[model samples]
Target: MNFDPQTLRYDERGLIPAIAQDAENGDVLMMAWMNADAVARTLQTRRVTYWSRSRQAFWVKGESSGHVQHLVDMRVDCDRDCLLVLVDQTGPACHTNRRSCFYTALRDGAEVEIMAPVADPD
Candidate 1:
């Protein structure tokens, strides 16, 4: 079956939420926004690309930092409004050097940091 990027549901800004997950361990890495073009670029290049809402431009993962996310697979949600990107993540996925962006946990009505940042490379 042929897949089309336009077939996916987008928000009013023509953007969709894309969640990056570790392909081998099944850990969720990060969540970002993507336009249709960003989605196409990621698929074509095997590199994760996102639309930076604050930067108002296309953001390629690991472009600036060395923490590259190589696309392993891309999945669409049942509602077609979200995406799950399985990737071979190199280094820390979070900008803070954490393995995943979901570092904080709300437990017993208290917020706690569940993960620590990885050590910097030499």
Candidate 2:
């Protein structure tokens, strides 16, 4: 059966959560939102694209940062409310320059930095 982006469940805003994972390492990199258009764009372009709720616009990964995420595969959750995107990621995935956005760990009721930011690309 052919896949349809519209078939996936979306919130009232027509958005769904998308998780990015490292294709080679199986490490979760980040989570973002995606509208149907963004989903189509990502599939068509083979590049991960997301909807920026804050900016109210389409955000193509690495558009300015050069930390692009090339889509290796895309998966839909059982409920179809979320997506898993396996990708070949370049550079850091977090705005803080860490390899992943989930760099903090909650241990013993305290937050601990589990990973350091990547060195400046320059």
Candidate 3:
């Protein structure tokens, strides 16, 4: 059976949550929103694409920062409201230059910085 992006449950805004994970190590990279069109584009191009609510546009990973996410696999949750995108991630996934967006950890009721920002290559 062919998978359909429309089959997935979307919110009122026609958006679904997509989580990016490192294909090699199973590390979760980041989470973003995606519309049906973004899903189709990601599958078609083998590059992860997201819907930027702030920009109200299609955000192709690594388009500007060179931190591209090449799709390895895409999975839908049991509820069909979320997506898991296994990808070969290049460079830091976080906009702050961290390896992941989830850089802060809540430990014992205190927030801790577990990871530091990546230094620019230049």
Candidate 4:
């Protein structure tokens, strides 16, 4: 069956949450927002694209930094309000140069640094 982006649920701002995960390791890389257009673009181009709420624009993963995320697959949640993007992540997925944006963990009511930022490339 064919997929349709309009069938997915979106927030008042016409946005939905999207999570990026490592296709091989299953490690979650980052979470971002996507509008219908971004979703369509990602599927059409096979490149992960996200809606930047702050910038109010479309952010194609690794467009500038070369930390590109090549879309392996895209999944819609049961509620159709969220997305899971399996990707071949190139470099750090976080602005801090970390592999994943989920670097902090709340354990036992304490915040802990789970992963350090990736060192800058030479």
RMSD of each: 1.3, 1.2, 1.3, 1.4
- Give residue 112's lDDT in candidate 3 (0 to 100): 100
lDDT of 4: 0.94
Question: Local distance difference test, per candidate?
Answer: 0.95, 0.96, 0.95, 0.94
Per-residue lDDT over 47-119 for candidate 1, one digit per residue giving the tens place of the 0 to 100 score: 9999999999999999999799999999999999999999999999999999999999999999999999998
Angstrom error of the Cα, residue 67, model 2: value is: 0.5
Clashes of 1: 0
lDDT string for model 2 (19-60, tens) is: 999999999999999999999999999989999999999999
Please identify model 2 stretches exceeding 4 Å from their true place.
none
Residues 2-98 of candidate 4: C-alpha lDDT, one tens digit per residue: 6789999999999999999999899999999999999999999999999999999999999999999999999998999999999999989999999
- How do these models rank on TM-score, best leading? 2, 1, 3, 4
lDDT of 2 at 105: 97
Q: What stretches of model 3 exceed 4 Å from their correct place?
A: none
TM-score of each: 0.96, 0.96, 0.95, 0.94
Candidate 1 Cα RMSD after full superposition onto the native fold (Å): 1.3
lDDT of 3 by residue, 1-122 (tens): 26688999999999999999999999899999999999999999999999999999999999998999999999999999999999999999999999999999999999999999999988
